[model samples]
Target: MPFYRFDHAPDPVEKAGFSPEEVPRAITAIGADLVAGMGLKEMGVHFHRKAQLIFTLRGIVRCEADDGVWIVPPRCAVWIPGGMPHSAALSGAVEIYCLFVDPDAAPALPAGCCTVAVSPLLEQLLRHAAHMPVMYDEDGPDGRIATVLLDQLARAPVEQLNFPMPQDPRLRRIAAALMADPADRATIEAWGKRMAAAPRTLTRALTRETGLSFGRWRQQLHILIALQRLDQGAAVQSVAQELGYESAGAFVTMFRKALGKPPARYLAERRRQDGNGAD
Candidate 1:
């Protein structure tokens, strides 16, 4: 697909006798308040001419890029490097924020796509920037805010929300099948038998390509799927059963071990961070 650049913010300086080019728009932002089933359900695979940061304060967005899937939960954002092909899926009620930055604006920021932790400070800055004029005074307060935002972005911590997909056709097929049917409780040997490969060969290929063992890789996918389902209001028991867990308690235990908290508390904390609820 052809690369596209979007200008969501328009410079009004030309009307004031000042050339629009005189202002340096290193960064620009767009915000939206979308209700359930009201906005884009998916952005088909495409590439952008500018680096992009997408986050939501009260909903979830699933992004696919860099041969991996990323979950953009509350208090987190997904960074897509310039010219990278990616797509996004959005649903439910969402208060989404997006930043389009000149690729050269921050050399220190991550060069690859990642899920980055969004600090409260950065979140507030994003909200502020989203409201500023497109061509605010470059030597004034707005300029300073843009500079600080870039600094904050460079310092943002990367989160472990990425579900890497292997490049091998066989492994890719397996990944797709698992995602399509996450409830499948098949063993390596069974999966291998279907692929016409030995269990050991399948395991080795997965580890070599994704830097994760077969079990770990599948678990990562499960965690990503579980987070999205839970965020969408699926009951814990329902989510566990959907994922083929024998019991809700088993699912909770696995979730706690993977994410450092149980499912309810985890989602609650995210809601609290988004100012939707109290601790």
Candidate 2:
């Protein structure tokens, strides 16, 4: 089904206890969904009234928003401000929880879309909040729970996981090819030959539009893609090879330079912080 319009998408939140005056704002995580690959129904962009925080429980989920394409792995989520058009892409099986908030009541969210790191406290809180009703009491346990959750969300650290896409058609060509095959090792000159624009024009457009050199932009792309592959339980060596690295050592160097740690160590540290690993 082609649901390009905002009205096409179903409303899952209002059905609960949500209303105009009872509780001006609320949070819910009960209706989580799991999927394998790009499901067409939710693939297209959808617009809704309330703000959203899409968290990944397992595997990786890729999404395109107003700012750019975000690489959402486990332990992280994308904050979509209310009334924005966004679309998602899937590569494999992924588990997810979507948290919808009222901007008026919860004004702590970023004014624009961005990726946020999920701390252990926030992770468990969202999991627990999923069971409560939509319009839980405002002065009881549920209310207190909601208040704490909101505070945590506002304090959650935002991550630099979004890969901004270039708007120029020329750069788009190169960008699309790289995304389709991250292993593509062709030079800009080589790619420009097939594109309508000249190599120099494409290079300049990339730098001007994205404020990043051609090489730097591709490296950023690789890292975002790397995060996705790594989240799928892929071995570091296997991912390096698949991404066209000359050697595992070289790939690790790049990963460390960009993310401040090697793949295994970084993930392990994240797990430890999330209290999923041994203390």
The parts of candidate 2 lying over 4 Å away from their true place are 1-24, 33-41, 277-279
- Alpha-carbon error at 173 in model 1, in Å? 1.8
Give the range where candidate 1 is weakest over 10 consecutive residues by summed lDDT: 14-23
* Candidate 1 error regions (>4 Å): 1-24, 276-279
The TM-score between candidate 1 and the true structure equals 0.85
**Candidate 1 lDDT, 1-279, residue by residue in tens:** 211112344544422333212236888776777787776578899877778899787667888899898877667899999889999888778878888888777878888999888877888889888777766677999999999999999998898888898888888899889888999999899998999999999888888878898878988988988887888789999999989999999999999999999999998887676673221
Clashes (backbone N, CA, C under 3 Å), per candidate, total: 0, 0
Model 2: lDDT of residue 70: 85
Tally clashing residue pairs in candidate 2: 0
**Candidate 2's residue-wise lDDT over 16-113, tens digit each?**
33432233557654434546655533478876677878887666678888747887866789998888989986555666666778767687679889
lDDT of each: 0.81, 0.74
TM-scores, all candidates, are 0.85, 0.85
Give lDDT: candidate 1, residue 188.
91
